[model samples]
Target: MKNVFTTLLLFSCLISAPSITAADERVKIIPDVVYGHKFGMALTFDVFQPEKPNGAGVLFMVSGGWYSRWTDPQNMLSWFKPLLDEGFTVFCVRHGSSPKFKIPEVVEDVRRSVRFIRLHAKDYGVDPSRLGVWGGSAGGHLSLVLGTTSDKGKPEAKDKVLQESDRVAAVAAYYPPTDLREFVDEKSPYYQRFPALQFDKELADDFSPLLQVTPDDPPTLLIHGDQDKLVPISHSENIMQQFKEKKVPVELLVIENAAHGFRGDDQTRASQAVVKWFQKHLAKQAD
Candidate 1:
């Protein structure tokens, strides 16, 4: 029975289709970096860089449920190995999920993860100036947070890492939840409350990416499925509207029949477009 249980756990960790394992890459925790860990909440991320890098990198967040596993960097090497081959360093971020940890706490952790990475860039062979972020759904919301709520160059306590800005150079999101307060309609099924005692709008509009966009933000690419039932196209549509108004350099990719994570040709193309965006934005750097 012991051996059987072990096998099942390993299988669950490995065969989980959407997960990316970080075992083969650099995996470590920047201790006490989390705002709160009373529920075992902590911030950790995996790093994948070329044996010899050219000078660019990205911090990638996985869209796990607000309460489930989203990525394992060890397995992700197979999917994003091509990017490493092309000389880009990849950071697979892992943060505490909900129920135990609230939604806002997780958001703060994502920002800390990016801030930690940028603070330790030299030790990891990463080029801090070229850092970017990517994700979907919940993770998308985080990427936006890191992009918009940049630290004001102030240190939290004596930790040098906390002083680092969480700002990202660019963003590539797929069917992301651009607005959290308005995400659920009567037709949706996910939990939309922070303990049944709060309205989402009171959660802070600055954290909403679509609402945070300014002329100063970096260029971005938004992709969505027109028929998505989980996160409707309207999320991206409204963001597109906001970007247009500010005249920010934003691009949108709408697929007619695809839903959620793209599969088949659409998936391949989405991956390619992400690589291209990183290369274009991150590569334009100074020594």
Candidate 2:
């Protein structure tokens, strides 16, 4: 059941899954652009530029259960049409897969991807400071991590990418596990399935977005199904509290009666909420 829900959640990342049409021509795609390298393998992301761009970028973390799978870029057109129609350059970023990379390395891989994008923002016709992020489940956890824990670049780093800040203007995370401390318990159910969570217990706090929030963290929107059993709604509720306490702009949209991954009208509503949240926070920056 867990595995089934994981697949369902990933497939439903699309915003209402619209059918592709000739209008797809309005979006130009640059596929497999390498961001970094790890263990001799290239880390990559695809860029989708709408003809009339808003000059802001929204990176969708391509992850499910910490596994970053690859599929035909063309198939993603309808999945991201809502954002593309809004003139946002959408970046579909894939990190190193889990069970091999683990959460610590996976987190760093995504951080590097953001830095790489920011370093070359001008070439992509985007403003580095006007970036936002979105994802679900494990991807959502990563998005929150980036939102709350992003840092200034290391001035002495020899790698140019390492010298670029990874901050984003806003974040939208769906059904994310904000606090990873539960995985630290050896007997916890998540520890057996998500090898990505099999990291040092002491480092759990470092990766948990709930523990990383700061007052300056970007405005965030969290969406979760009230009935989600895989990752309980409590995850979002708990972090929502922290965001409120810190006075960071935040909103939690709970979809009543929905499960791990939304279906039918629930998915559509969640999708619209995310699009609206990004527009509210990122549009001003684009202007």
Which number leads on TM-score? 2
User: How much does candidate 2 score in TM-score?
Assistant: 0.95
lDDT tens digits, residue span 91-136, model 2: 9999999779999999999999899999999999998989999999
Task: Report clash pairs, candidate 1.
Answer: 20-72, 20-73, 21-72, 21-73, 21-74, 21-75, 22-73, 22-74
Off by over 4 Å in 1: 1-41, 68-72, 183-189, 192-200
Model 2 residue 45 lDDT?
Answer: 97
Residue-level error in angstroms, candidate 1, position 271: 0.4
> Could you tell me how far off, in angstroms, the CA of residue 48 lies in candidate 1 after the best superposition?
0.9
The whole-model C-alpha lDDT of candidate 2 against the native structure comes to 0.89
Per-residue lDDT for 1-287 in model 1, tens only?
Answer: 34422321231233245544463354332222233243454455667766667667787775444443545445567566656766788777767665566567677677777778788889778778788898766666677767766765566657676688777888888777777654333233344332211224467475577778787777787888787766688888898788888887788888779766566687777777888888888885563
Q: What are the models' TM-scores?
A: 0.80, 0.95
